[model samples]
Target chain A: MKELKILAVIAALVGITYYGIEPYAHSVMHPEVSAADFTFKDAKNVDTSLAGNVENGKVLVEANCIACHAIEKAGHPALMPNADAAASYGVVPPDLSHAGRIYDKNYLANFIFDPVSAMHLSHKYPVGGTKAFPMPSYNWMTPQEIMDVVSYLQSVAPKVTEDKEGHKATFEAACGRCHSMAYAKFDATTPKDSIKAYMGATPPDLSQYIKSRGEHYLHSFINDPQVLLKNTSMPRVGLNEKAQEEVIAYMEEIGDSKKAERESLGLWVMLYTFVFAILAYLWKRKIWSEVH
Target chain B: MAEFKQADSMYEWFDQRLGIDKFVKVMMTEYWIPKNINFLWAMGVLLTVMFTLLVVSGIFLLMYYKPDINMAFDSVNYTIMQEVAYGWLFRHIHAVGASVVFLIIYIHMFTGIYYGSYKRGREMIWISGMLLFMLFSAEGFSGYMLPWGQMSYWAAYVITEIFGGIPLIGGDLVVWIRGNFYVADATLTRFFMLHVLLIPLAILGAIVFHFYALRFPHVNNEAGEFFDFDEEAEKYLAGDKKNSKVVPFWPVFLSKDFFVLGFFLLFFFYLVFFHYGFAMDPINFDKADGLKTPSHIYPEWYFLWSYEVLRGWFFEIAGISGKSLGLMAFGFANIIFLLLPWLDRSPMVKPANQRPYFKYWFWLMIADLMVLTEFGKLPPTGPNAWVGFGASLVFLILFIALPFITKAEAKKVGGK
Candidate 1:
């Protein structure tokens, strides 16, 4: 009986050891990396065709930008194209394809050299007008590289357009389920207190008010609402500044567009519940095994 | 007639109730314990009891202990201060108990070597005992780090990095075990799991098998005599003539054991209560931060010999990169101990029976160990390192040359 007891104890120990150490062994043998391959050359490679002069702007990007940003044609796998514009690495990669049509060489040059002073938004690149991602400063970049990159960008980028119809449809598809039109009338019986209580803040009527706010302010406010208001309750709309401005313009043209307001909220609720259910199931299984 | 019948009935009833006769029969006939066992024989039982104490106290502590780096030190303090009832007593007993265990085991091995217990028919037992000693050391050192104290942190960092001395893949191997460039949360967590679970379980199993093998031939005494059955008396006796005193183990040997146990308890209580055992260092109360190197780093006293040897060897070879040679010498020193049972082979088992040459070398080894330990404790200054290095080289020479001298002495005696 004593021998049997010893054997049983040894068996249990061996079982536990195998279970505990095997996972660590597996982890050590194989390390995990993300699918996005961000190489150094892509961010720093200078486009000679964009700039009339042969400049070393690519070297500046390599030293300062490649740590976080990837500027290659492949950008990042998760980013998708919308309305012929492509978002890169979940951020709007300002398209140099149309730079020549918009800002002049000098405006672009000033913006690149000291972006904080030129943009007046407390950040260099205010994508979707939100501070979700901030561009790192390249103070070490020489004045010539800055001029060359800006000149290169100005030569290649296309003219900026104010298209409303395409943006309105996409906005409705993505966000209409969650929000109501800013000007949707409140019922007399529906207490004003309900709006403050339900929305958790004063919901603004954007139908007429949005026109007064320029495309830049509307774009900045939606992309990163906190950048404009320190305590804004509005969730970041997750759009790039250019996309945000287009959406705001689209909303103003349609005056009280109801499609986006109705659908976005329900989709968000369903998506959250689905994720919660899967997590709950896994947790329950883990607890059950421990108890047994 | 009636009185005689009543007495007979009483005898039968007593036999049925107590089974005293059967117990006596088993005690007299079935028990085969050796009669020639000595003080060194008690070490096995003492070690067993110490291991039991450690495991029981460890489990109790583990109940309240949290192994995470952020929580480990606080949890130990909590165990002592708030959570478990009388937890501090158990924690201190276990902590001090570890040192005491090693102390006893070292004496046991020294006794074994002095009496030549690792001779023919007992070499396997000695080897197994040596393996157990190594395992125990590993178990204790690994467990020390689980508390994530300042000493535990520094001790682990210095010790584990010793493996980095292995030429080509050394640095990578150390980093792999550490899970980062420096000892961090991953290293703490890994050490904790190994300490609490893996190594202890291995040591426990090995100890059981070790004793099982030990029981077969029984213990060799200071007189180096085995047991011989006296056919005329129907009992076992020592092989040696002068030492052949036969006594039942229960009454005679039990008395001596009780006397030893009493002294042991007195000393233990005095250390635990009156003398105030190992002081809990305030530095150990702090968490391990690898970026912050401690002013002085030293291992526990038991490891001082090897530590000293490495330090001394490095110092002597000052021109030849002390760090590399010091690490190599320390490792080589440990491997030498592992080779002892095979290295020292003589027909004689007892110290008195052995040649004078072997005796001198044995004492010299002990003295070298003490000097090395002292040298290990000193900082590796240029002069100290050189002195230590010279001392380490002398010790190594004595250690290797002793066996050859013993062999030569044995050959001379055989010729005579």
Candidate 2:
């Protein structure tokens, strides 16, 4: 009875600390927030009746986008080199080769229409802010023109197969310009200093983010950085849901690839240990039988 | 000693030269252990088993583990976990073993205190065990740095900074210990050596001392009864096994030990396989960035209570700063258990249940430690700070009051 009482005390103390207090503390420290909505509701809508013309879109991209941006898959390189572009724009602009596959359509349209407001970056570039936003908004383009540009980009974009290569390609296109995957031996394409100046801080290496921030948090944070962290330098990446899933999958593959192996092996280890425990208990009982 | 003439077999040849049979008799078969002791006494054996697991797993980890700051994080996370075969299993076992070994150590310690095993002749055993505890704590702290992650970097940074609280040479002491102004490459390499080599060897030596100390007083029983080992072991070896309170260590005592070990392994491996998240902090997954510190940082669970004791002294008393006072209190809290043999002056040999005040004291100590550990993890702000401060003060007051309370209890026991 006394031993049982002592056990109860220990169990109670351990339980209250681990289960009760720890969770309570964690809840306070990391208060849960709803995932960011990726509806892109407020963006100016493209008229669905007018079908996009890829040829017109190509003409438009050459006229408007080529001076500053690149569509390497479409054989139009940026007029300015990466070093000059980084110096000028504060970061090397991403190549538009996989933009259509990676970004949500509505989000991309909105981003082009109003680069400042679309990325939830109004706080960074205020009406009377000292520095101008790097990318100029193409507000004059009609809805049909915008749709055509989107279509052209999509047509030239390499098809992203649902596999490790696809995920890696998507991640590199979307995030690798700014964030490095150090574990995968992938470095950010843009110079670190330029990125620091552009984003107000260099983006963290994404190697172990899956383990640290976890899947749900990553989803919310990537969908809209400002929602979780007020005025975070990180812009909304505007990855489509599928693209987002792929990015997260790639992160997990890099960071926690052994998770499946660990889980599968756990069951076998548990079974073996359980059988051993049962046998040991029986043997203990048998040995004690002689003494008793 | 002079009777052996020729080798009967390979084993006998070795035995003739090595006294293997005599060694087994002294250590196991003829060695006596109390039969009346319960499963709580099994904690010592469980601790040994866990130590062996840690060492075996640690050896595997050491094969691929890099000490350099540039490669350490990748060596652990990428090379070990992803590249090497079954490396994750070994890492999980080592990580979880390091954490769970403390749990068994705490249980063993509390069991000793509850039964007053440290009260009289068992002082050396208790002291040697405390020495091992200190070594294990050092081992855990140093080993944590091998991952080169956010928590590891900051924990080493924060703990090493604690030395700056010392007077006169304090500032230099910190830099000296780190071998630099900060916990950088030099610090990491030295801690790597300590974790992998120095502290482990010290711990092995201390374990030998602890077991050697145990051999003298033998093991105390559940009822805190003292019996002559030779007398009871004779009864046990004769036909009066049922009447004897002692049994031989090898077959009879080891059967129970192995049984308890089975259940312990079940719980331990369950942690190593499934519930290992608690042992490995998520923040630690992030590679260490000296430029960017995490928003919140705390030590591992085992050190939380003492850590809280340091943090709890939140305000300056007189001219002495809270940091200095905290550092002293933290040091005191860590080593206070070593003084337990002399602190409780009560002559009573029975368990805490037989002593009125000591029972409440023991339970209260357990509860206070839990509170300290819990609050230690939370941000030291507002109510958390006050609660921790109160608990820490209570912790000190309890130890301070021990001699007086036990002295009065001793008088009463003597009167009875």
Candidate 3:
């Protein structure tokens, strides 16, 4: 009779567990929003021709962005002094080196057209507390030109393109700025002591990252590393929803080729365990018969 | 009773050579346990399984995890989850396991409180478990910092800054804990080391001590009487006591243990797979920016009650700043478990369920904790602040009044 009572309690516990998770699973788990819509008065002309045209976008970037924003990566200092520009603007212009990995095209285009609004800037500080250093809105230049400049910025952004193919595209694009990924191609001949260091720790090799952590771990992680984990020095890479999915999809494609196969096997494991439980229960009841 | 007499030939050979037979006879097959213990006895075994799962999953996570600030979050988010094979399963197991461990611990503790398991000659056993709970809180706080999320940053700042509210050397102490002027790489490095290695070893030592402190032949039952174990053992060993009532630890309890463990596993895996986000704070999704301080900062659910107590002291008292007093109150609340043995002055050792007034007070304390925990998540203003302040006073009164309240009730019931 007592054993039956225990079993009844176990059944109730399972019901309680289901109840505990129902509300959370329903309301919080599968969040629904209208696809992060960001449209404007004139988006049609900008949206049509300049989606992925790298060539025409480069020319537009050279004409406008080259004055302050250096898009390309190079070994030496810029030929022109940028100190006067910083003093006048009150803040150094952020490098557009990995803008593609950092910012999605939608945000980049939106920011280009209206920096004050897209970046949540207040009217009190048109250029973030600098009255004279306002970012000139390219809204006057047909949205096509602004989009072309965005395309140009993304085209120049660092990407892992089969060169070693170990460090990821987004990883190389964002993290490669300060960290070295040479460890990806390290071998028997490589000198361990000669390895480059960044941020006081050996710039971690992220070659096997996707194959090792929990799924859905990266979305919030990349959105805001510090917010996801506190006191972390990792700045938000600023990927929009679509770009975030693309990066993660690329990572999953490369890192976990056998993911589908492995997850499919979980069913077999549960089935085997369920069968064993029935046998185990019968054996336990038989063994305890004498005691009662 | 001699189930091993006709064991396999290989086992007989090994037992003769290595004393395996004698060891098993002494410990496993021969060890006797009381048969009347309730369902709550399963919690200890449940806790052990949870700990083992945490360690195993933690090791897998630590393998690909980068402790560096710039690399840590990205490595966990992008590399591990996206690239690793079954990495998500392992990480979820560890993350969800941390939250579940506390739930199991609360059950284990309340069982002890309800059954009066912390009776005469078993003070050390209770103390060891309490000490382990303290260590777990530290481990949880440090591990939370590893993700470097928004809550991780602000919670760390808010909690650590409370130390700066100290009269003297508080500033120095804050820097000492952070290993810098603010939370940085150095803090993360130390937290990683402690979470992975040092603290786990200490917890393991505490578990060993807790088991050792469980005195022989007396499994403190709901009847609440401390039996004379030496006298009971002598009669049983001499074969003069026909009604031994004690059963071998192997088949009797081991089978039941496995049965209970199966249910726990089902419950645990369900959470790890489907509902892991329930324990996680949503605000933590944003990256930590030092310049931006979030409007409302809250700790994890387990720490909320204490955080509410800390926040309750909004008004200055006795010439000391409320913040400084709050720091003291928070620290004391955590350490207050140490006073449990002395605080309840009832001479009777009856199960708390039998003590009517004590039972009422016990539920009140639990309700008080529930309210404080809820208030901790809300903005500290309006009813949330004032009610939480009132609740904090009630929390103190519950502890202070326990001995007097329970003692008076015992006289009416004639329990002793």
Predicted structure with the largest TM-score when compared to the true one? 2
Candidate 1: C-alpha lDDT: 0.57
Residue A123 displacement in candidate 2 (angstroms)? 2.4
lDDT at position B312, candidate 3: 80
**Which ranges in model 1 have alpha carbons more than 4 Å from their true place?**
A1-292, B1-40, B226-233, B236-255, B276-279, B315-320, B352-354
Instruction: Work out the TM-score per prediction.
Output: 0.52, 0.94, 0.67
Stretch of 10 with least lDDT, candidate 2 chain B:
B407-416
lDDT of 2: 0.88
lDDT of 3 by residue, A1-292 (tens): 7756755854564344434333432343334322333232222334534565677777777677666765556222343444444443433355577676567566667667766454443333344564532368777776677767776676666654532242355544544443333324322111223222112233334333343333455666665554344544344445666456655665565554445654555555455556655666676677566555
Question: Please, what are the lDDT tens digits per residue for candidate 3 over residues B7-108?
Answer: 478878678567897887656666665655666777887888899999999999999999988888666655666567777777777878898898788778
Clashing pairs in 2: none
Report the poorest 10 consecutive residues by lDDT, candidate 1 chain B.
B232-241
Worst 10 residues of 2 chain A by lDDT: A41-50
> Looking at candidate 1, what is the lDDT of residue B193?
78
How far does residue B212 in candidate 1 sit from its true spot (Å)?
Answer: 2.1
Better of 1 and 2 by TM-score: 2
Model 2 collision count: 0
Error of 3 at B144 (Å): 2.2
